[model samples]
Target: MEPEQQPNNSVVVVMVPLTAQSHLNKLLQFAKIISSRGVPVYYMGSTMHNRQAKDRVHGWDPSTISNIHFHDCQLQLPQVITPHHDLYFSKMFPLHLLPILIQLREPLSSLLRSLSATARRVVVVHDSLMSFAAEEASLISNVEAYYCFHCVSVFALLYLQWEAFGKPIDQGLQGGDIIPRDLPRVSFEGCFPEDFSEYAAQNIQWSMLDVGNIYNSCYAIEGRFLDLMAQHQSDKMLWAIGPTNPVAFDSSAGVHHKCLEWLDKQPQSSVVYVSFGTTTSLSDAQIATDGLDICNDEVIKQRFIWVLRDATDGLDICNDEVIKAQLPNGFEERTKRVGMIVREWAPQLQILAHSSTGGFLSHCGWNSCMESLSMGVPIAAWPMHSDQPRNTMLVTEVLKVGLVVLKSLI
Candidate 1:
């Protein structure tokens, strides 16, 4: 069971995140941590994705760091497939990038080999969706590969494994289904997107077989699940190295000073900061109804900031006119004195860290959840899709730090 000898001098960590903002952010945060410790990192992605990564790094003051490199695999995707719709791209892009990644492995390895001579090793850390491709490429190039679960709890991983490999937990278990008996109770129903159950099942199977796994979580919060994972899956190495907020590493000046300035004006722990991550979009109907309810409520109206991102694949709500048309008539004018509606991107980490920020109205995405918890801000979990429901459960039911806002209320 001796470890294989690597070439000397340089250590290279290749990060291949699914072409999603959240996924990329997590991997980049991990890469920064690795690079800060003296290892060189090669962040691999499609040409467009690499460009975006470069821009993001530049925004974060890249000149301060020298070891993290953006390696474009030169994947030319079709015009029909845009980066904004990362959910679709996550499933499809790998088919196109896999062969290209496989081909680039040798050149990547050779380039790393040329760097130095004392324990030179190239480790491929990839998003869960890209694990299959990364595993094949790592095998071909004789490099180490690890699956990075950028979002989701350790319990989510365990659930996926159980669903995929273990006997079907009674189909009739309904919303009250408790899983794994030992772990904290989480609703089995609506925990995952029903449409992609099969896809998730397959990924979980492969992820279990992979060399190891990385999570954007830490033992401080999810130690029980981590411990359970270790007890059961002793053969696999699970690293809980996160709460990986980019603000910890990036010193991007003036990114959101205005937001902070406004926050400073508010009473401490009085404002409720609201955001639904990057991907989830509120339907026009939901916005007209539920959106107005929250905005117009006397209690919530006085101290709220809602970040409303455009529906990437569907509507162009980024246009002020479009946003106006979608919102309930006079909603903005009604709440203008008390609330702020951010149309596009907002500097989330800064806002969450602010003293004036009392609570979070979040989609319960793992990143959002972690950021909120890290800042000691409570939450009103309103999950829209994917692993969010499960994360909501962790926040509300297990952690006792948050409450779930039922979709019926939203």
Candidate 2:
């Protein structure tokens, strides 16, 4: 691999997710695209937990092609703050980001102003939640900007961008910034209307997650007065690129099927890999936070590979210790003979695509949904947050391919 040139300018991409689930995944995909093209991509986020993951994409050998340079440019904590548990503080990045832009816009802009300023142009791609600040940074810096929506453009236009798209900048929410109203507010169902063109395909799994749910298909989903509000910017400057999460079982680069390598070496399709996705530590909004904890002890008499985290606090572990304690039971000893590999860090896509992989146990994040769909694998949807219930709605309710363990109860 060719070493990267000392970039003359940089494109700062920020993903300041109010809540860090599928939103972060979207920003990373865009960073991957820009980096794939050899642009200098500096991704930023509000919290360190999210930022640490942002730090890892640069060294990704997934495709055996490393073209992106990752850097952390935005920090939003430990200052001017309204404290809350996993909730998002929107003002942290922008109110503070403007100050940083003053320092960065000049020299960096001068260097990347030209297409061939001895380096790739500095572009800013932010998650929709934080794109307004990125937009401000781009205006002063004279660089390009884009927003990454890992799911469909629907939620990107509505849910994440609700404040920017729905409410005027000056108007405070009905509740303070921390408490997002429980009712569905912003709507974009009409803007990104459903296109069921893929329904004809034989492998219906790729179409597992619906655009309707991803973007909130309700008619009330879009902002009311969009035409006038929309013209604030030119179509050429702003972009909605990538719903680009490419994966394959046959190896070429980005991600290939080597699940078999691990599963093949191990045992049967008995092992189960679980990852609700990064943003699910907080209680899921749509699904009841109750009953979303670990499964009950009845093992179905099978060996397993469970990919879980220490999410007891969020799952209400103290109140739900019975469920937790039952996890390592008489079945584990007997099941251990069947073999069990438990981990918090598993190559999930690889695990799901394995030949011996009997099935998947997922929280139904769109990316993970698509991964399983691309592999035509079935799952046990344990949806955990905002659109996850909706995304899971598409998975189990619409597709009829997967099963929800406790749907009647949740």
* Best-fitting candidate, scored by TM-score: 1
lDDT of 2: 0.41
Candidate 1: the clashing residue pairs are 7-120, 8-117, 8-118, 8-119, 9-117, 9-118, 9-119
- Compared with the true structure, all predictions reach lDDT values of 0.62, 0.41
- How close is each model in CA RMSD to the real structure? 6.5, 12.6
Provide the lowest-lDDT 10-residue window in model 2: 209-218
The digit string of per-residue lDDT tens for model 2 on 129-239 reads: 333434343444344443423344233223334443556433423333311234224323322112311111211232222121112122222233122123432242323
Candidate 1 whole-model C-alpha lDDT, 0 to 1: 0.62
> Highest lDDT among the candidates is held by which one?
1
lDDT of 1 by residue, 1-410 (tens): 11223346555676767665667677777778888898777776655665555444313644468877776665444333323322432332123333333454444444334432344456767787655544344444335455555467775666655555554533213333334443444445554444455554555555664677788888889887777667656787778988776534243463655666778788889888888765565666666666667666554555788887643322122223333225666776877766778865577777887788999998887878888898899999887766676777678777889997755222
